[model samples]
Target: MDVKVQKNLLCLSREAAEFGPFDAILELEGEPDALWFYREHVSRGVPCIWRGAVAHWPAVSKWSNDYLRETVGSKEVSVAITPNGYADAVREDLNRFVMPHDQLMPVSQLLDVIERKEDFPGICYLQRQNSNFMEDFAELWKDTDLDIAWASKAFGAQPDAVNLWIGDERAVTSMHKDHYENLYCVVRGEKHFILLPPTDRPLIPHMKYASARYQLDLASREFSVVDEKDHGVIPWIPLDPQKPDLNRWPQYRHAHPLRCTLKAGDMLFLPSMWYHHVSQSQGAIAVNYWYDMAFDMRYAYFQCMDAITDTVAEGNCCAVGDHDIEDEQELSTGKT
Candidate 1:
């Protein structure tokens, strides 16, 4: 058999034997100690949900629209506005990967649009991940913890970024992995996640496209795609987990996706380098802590696998930091 064909068969076999065994994400009733968390989930690269992890958090009960308005309504914050709910996703019509139009608005105005009390021309999301909870919404910090105690102890460091996310139901996070161990906490509504482990990287397809940004014309309430002429190109996963086009990307058929819905007060320990696509209920609010992934043997091994997969997939090199739109201040993209 040919080398590429052999690699493909190997991936299929691995999917059957190794990947298919773990059909569900482990859900824990109470918070585990740092040692238990590391041994069971963190060290092994397993994802788990700690039910009612932050149920006692004041934010869970106090973070209503009226409360938010009373607390931080007048504050000016960054919002990602897009014609469609998708920010930082492949725009098939334009044949480009586009970022959302970043707009500055008061917290009150953003809530108005989310609540449908006021008619907004475009979908607005406060999904900026640059520690927005600490910097932008500092006034509301008293409601939630600065960092998860056990998680910080297990990681042996403070969180690099604590992000706040509040958005419309249509706002979708595209499939991508991060170089950080993420602890995502839902405060208001439910968030649905479609997760694929790093071991299944061989089945995922990546494509390179010219980068663009959404430019909104407030006067006419229209969005235009503006090409990033200077930035050149970016490699992104164009596959939508909700509707995987198997014909175009057949390898995706071999991928095993674990679906989980995180309701209010739930915290999901999303391991590093796991590809995920996320969607949320309307007016959902969330906060996530990103701890930098250790560049250890596991990371080096992953790089080797990534290189081999790319080589076997017609020389498609895995783009490092391409999907690092979480830090939009440094990276440019519309979605997280």
Candidate 2:
């Protein structure tokens, strides 16, 4: 879990081994030369262990659950009250308003109604109209801003909006990807985020799964089925990227998967287009926020036109994106 170099360590490569993956290692353990390289580079990607992250704030500590629940459940209001005042809850909501409705909004009418707070006399049933909760929230990340990291303020102008998220064991966002960049801060309790890269759009074959191809039938409030095959009986095949489990999806080894671990004060940077999955560790948690605009996101642009959410496991296949993608390729390749 340790990334920094300890003293008496000979040759930086020996120290960097702890991080795994020999693709491109950066051992900055007390190395001024290595640290200097990152500062000068553009589009930097570095995973630093828990260094100096902050604790939860009164507002966040006081009511993060209340905020996410209120926002996700409410059919209206992109901005919410954060005990402090009116503020943008997420940049994606704003982007939803600005982006063409057909391109992003889950519901078209939702956007038509989202005029600036100045004009629309608070919609009767909306959160702002009926609730006493504060409308503004401060960004979660105020201290750990790295120069190599993307300029969140420039892209998102996310000075006050929340970029970080925290929740209890109950916090669950049914498989879905956000339109904005994310820096996860794990403080307390446990949260699990399941993620798939953008290229692997097939994984979101079900409503239970995240996908771009599946269109929402607002009138029925139901998902339109894309494939005729009863996924319950047969499993889809997928290419594995990480340590392939042949007993599971043998093909998984072929697929390049990216995983991460974030402990207390541990922050994770998700560059645009990278599919992510998160699981809250069991413990106390805290995090800051930052957001960026204009990403060539994989979802909105590339639809999940085919079924791909199927997963493999203890002998069973579920239709709603939970099928075992039996990697036939694994057997042929001698991986299984």
Candidate 3:
């Protein structure tokens, strides 16, 4: 379609309306697709995601040469990829964090390992603050294929202990949003992301802020975010962030979902407090930058803010880095 690029423009009410429902993007393929695009042979409809992204994926691959031009099965298409299977397979090879072997190993020498992957395994984590990241964060800025200079403008202060996720199609996360404004970007394959505005967040089921703590305890692998807990599955419950269950906490339902997708070279401007969910379609891979309010909030000056910060970033890890503030103060302080 007609993808328009605007500079220094404010999203008018109509232009900003894309946030209410989910959206999808397609075709922007590139080189990496060659390495990761294995012949699935299974022809199926797309997926049940709200929005999907597919930018810069490789059009061809060395391995794909064998099955080039071959339709999936009896049909004209080519692969039979099971989304759940794909998600499981991708989680196999990714390092929890792939922080450049170049900084530690020089680029030319390690190019092979970087270019050789059957599928993309995703990476996710929580880390402490690094001051150097603000001034001239080389990796995030110098290397990003997108407008890092423009993208970096949206940080208040960098967060100390914030959640970070990166990966390929195999790195599919369940559709969920936390009490945080997210910065989602696609460096590799196209990244499909969906978000819920604060008004819709209550529809997302949540647990006591303290009980789930990253809800899916990665340490134990108890990834039950919604519903109630059964023996092991943690029982999936639909938590409406806007209208919470009084029986449970009686104060949930306030959150909403406002979602979208980001192709390679694309960036998302998430206001604090917005809830989001994402899935990578086909050969898409991506990463995200999440900021908690304890973060530096100066970037508010750039993102079309008519007044002060309207959406406060709040959720599970609300005041993780605030050494001086007590838990009580953490809950009380939100975007003003």
Please give the CA lDDT of all the candidate structures: 0.84, 0.31, 0.30
Worst 10 residues of 3 by lDDT: 1-10
lDDT of 1 by residue, 258-321 (tens): 9999999999999999999999999999999999998999999888877766665664432222
Q: Which stretches of candidate 3 lie over 4 Å from their true place?
A: 1-141, 145-156, 159-166, 207-259, 294-336
In candidate 2, where is summed lDDT lowest over 10 consecutive residues? 1-10
Model 3 TM-score relative to the real fold: 0.35
Q: Residue by residue across 235-301, what tens digits does model 2's lDDT show?
A: 2122223223345433232233444454544445454444444444322344434454354433434
- Residues 267-320, candidate 3: write the lDDT tens digits: 454545444445664434344454453223433432333221112122232211
lDDT rank order = 1, 2, 3
Which of candidates 1 and 2 reaches a greater TM-score? 1
How many pairs of residues collide in each model?
A: 2, 48, 56
The alpha-carbon lDDT assigned to residue 323 of candidate 1 equals 35
For every candidate, C-alpha RMSD to the true structure in Å: 8.9, 15.0, 17.6
Q: Which is the leading candidate under TM-score?
A: 1
